[model samples]
Target: MNFEAAKTLCRSFPGVTEDTKWGNDIVFSVGDKMFAVTNLGEATGMSFKVEDERFLELTDRPGIIPAPYLARAKWVYVEDAKALGDAEAAELLRRSYELVFGKLTKKLQREIGGA
Candidate 1:
């Protein structure tokens, strides 16, 4: 998905927050923990968490690679924003949001109404 679409999808999730980080990156977070990130500069790429089991499989795909500095955590960076179809991109992003949200404390989850 492109940056605008990604932004919209991420903001639709419960308790999601958007912020500009590192001057050229846009980050999407839930309960203060990031789940997605995209570039604000010339590059067209997006990164988000993925299930551990799917990391290697995803990174092996063309236009997709292990996210820099976050590969150990199973995040994948989509080098081409349109590499995955819209539906697939949406699904991955939703999964990323769920994974991060699941890590939040129960109380925080409840406070965010995402439990």
Candidate 2:
């Protein structure tokens, strides 16, 4: 999946936003909290959260590694964004969105709901 595709999928979720930060990095957020990021200049790049169990499983694969500064938080960096396939990548993005969205306060969720 390319960054453009990723950004399109990410923005499909409620209360989602995107921005270019740290120069060339594309950051995706929900409720103002980041859930995924990728370096635009990199040939193949995407960093996203996964379940802790999958974290151990994924990092064992080639072209995948603990994301810099966010590994401990269960984020994995995909050297080739398409490594996971388009459908799988979309699923992961939704899961990441749900995980981050679920953490928001009830009030915030309600407000978002109203929006």
Candidate 3:
């Protein structure tokens, strides 16, 4: 998907926020934590977190790769947007939001819940 489409999808998540971080990378967040990031200026790819098992399955798929440095645990990179359709991209974003939200502290969860 194009940048605008990507941004639109990301912003649909509850409390999701976007900004440039780590040298031109576009980062999407819920609360203060990141769930997805795009290297639009340099790599033309997006990095996102998935369950460890799911991350393995996705990285094994064609055109998907383990995100550099961040892949040791839960991140994967979509090397080309064309390899993933809009539905898949939205699913990934949803999974990421769930994963990150699940990890938030009880107080934070309550705060986010109130939002």
Candidate 1: regions farther than 4 A off: 41-43
Estimated TM-score for each candidate: 0.92, 0.89, 0.86
Against the reference, the lDDT scores of all candidates come to 0.89, 0.83, 0.81
- lDDT tens string, model 1, 1-115? 6666877899899999989999999899999999999977554889999999989888998999999999999999998765788788899999999999999999999999943
TM-score sort, best first: 1, 2, 3
Candidate 1: clashing residue pairs, number: 0
Candidate 2 vs. true structure, TM-score: 0.89
Residues 4-103 of candidate 2 have per-residue lDDT tens digits of 6876788788887888899888888988888999766543688998888899888988878899999999999988664677788889889988888889
- Return the clash pairs for model 3, or none: none
Better of 1 and 3 by lDDT: 1
Give model 1's TM-score versus the native structure. 0.92
User: Which residue window of length 10 is worst by lDDT in model 1?
Assistant: 37-46
**Better model by lDDT: candidate 1 vs candidate 2:** 1
Kindly list the per-residue Cα lDDT of model 3 for residues 28-104, writing each as its tens digit.
Answer: 88878999888655547788899887887888888789988889858988877776788878888789988998888
Badly placed stretches (over 4 Å) of model 2 are 41-43
Model 2, poorest ten-residue lDDT window? 37-46
Worst 10 residues of 3 by lDDT: 1-10
Which candidate should be chosen as best, given lDDT against the real structure? 1
